[model samples]
Target: MRVVILFGSEMGTAETVADSVADALSAHDVSVYDMSDFAVDDLDVHDFHVIVCSTYGDGDLPTGAEPFFDELDACAPDLSGLRFAVFGLGDSIYGDTFNRGGEIAAEKLVARGAIQVGEHARHDASTEIRPKEMARDWAATLPVPALTSA
Candidate 1:
């Protein structure tokens, strides 16, 4: 399947995670994109997507993701058949807003009728865990035939 990995980063961590996810999905036709550069209308229902984003400013979407979500909101595009997965990077020290960026992105996408596949993965900065490793592992679980089968 055609897989697009989109990333939103404030300090490049999410971008790094995106690359990691891409590496794990190397067997497929995968492309990595910066959320700020991708167009909302370009999301095709026939393709699969992975979102890697980092929370910023008290659970707010990162700077790079702001434009994409804004455009997505404005366009209100129909994504009934589109499938996606999310990987969020955040610090647990933030309390209730922990990993909120990915949560918000997922919520918005779902609200627009996009179908989400796989578990919503999160990497907490407060932990000793490596974000890239977690993201790669999470991504590996997503490309299964059962998950992608229409």
Candidate 2:
């Protein structure tokens, strides 16, 4: 199935992670786009999606992602046939808000009727973990056929 990797970041960490995910799914038809350049209407039900996003201040969506989410919220498109997975970057030091950006994205997508497949992966800045590798592994485990045949 075709896969699209979208990223949202301020300092580009999420973009880097998204690149790794693309590499991991290189065998498949894959495309990567920055959230700032992608529109909500671009979502295709036939394709699988991976969202790589980093939480900004107070666990809010990064600057690059706000516009896309705003548009999605405004359009409120029915994404019932869309399938996706999420990988979030955050600092656990923030306790309650850790990885909230991904959480918010997932929530919005689900609210629009999108089906999320596989695990919701999160990378904590407080650890020495490598987000790119983590994201790549996470992408590899996504159920590509989950909604493609629906």
Candidate 3:
């Protein structure tokens, strides 16, 4: 299956976690990319999308994903045939806005016609929830069609 992994990070912790997730997916033959380096206009090319972005400041999407998010909001793609999942990294101490960035991204994707496969994952760095574990579990649950031998 064609899977895309997009992530945003500040101090690189989230990026490191995203890399691990990508490596795991690659072992399964899935393609992945860091949101900062991935082409946003090519979002329509993927069959499945996994978003792993971190919230910064007072609930803002990391610097790398802001432009893409804006484009998505402005020209909402018709993603009726696409399936997606989201994993958000944030600190619960932010109170009301904790993980709001990821929440917004997921909501916008749905609004633009993407089908969410399962529950959105919110991993709190300030809490007990581990982002890597959550990402691994989330990837394992994706409805990717079984690979067939040539």
Q: Against the true structure, whose lDDT is highest?
A: 1
lDDT for each residue of candidate 1 in 1-150, tens digit (9 for 90 to 100): 689999999999999999999899887788999999999989988889999999999899999999999999999998998899999989999999999999999999999999888999989999989998998788878844434545
lDDT of 2 by residue, 27-145 (tens): 77889999999999899999999999999999999998999999999999999999999999999999999999999999999999998889999999999878987887888788877
- Stretches off by above 4 angstroms in model 3 are 146-150
Off by over 4 Å in 2: 146-150
| Local distance difference test scores for all models | 0.92, 0.91, 0.74
Among residues 3 or more apart in sequence or in different chains, the pairs in candidate 1 whose N, CA or C atoms overlap within 3 Å are none
Q: Which pairs clash (backbone N, Cα, C closer than 3 Å) in model 3?
A: none
Model 3, range 3-93, lDDT digits (tens) per residue?
Answer: 6778877667667667667766764556656676775568763557778888888898888788777787777777776778788888889
Report the error of model 1 at residue 42, Å.
0.7
What stretches of model 1 exceed 4 Å from their correct place?
Answer: 143-150
Q: What is the lDDT of residue 14 in candidate 2?
A: 95
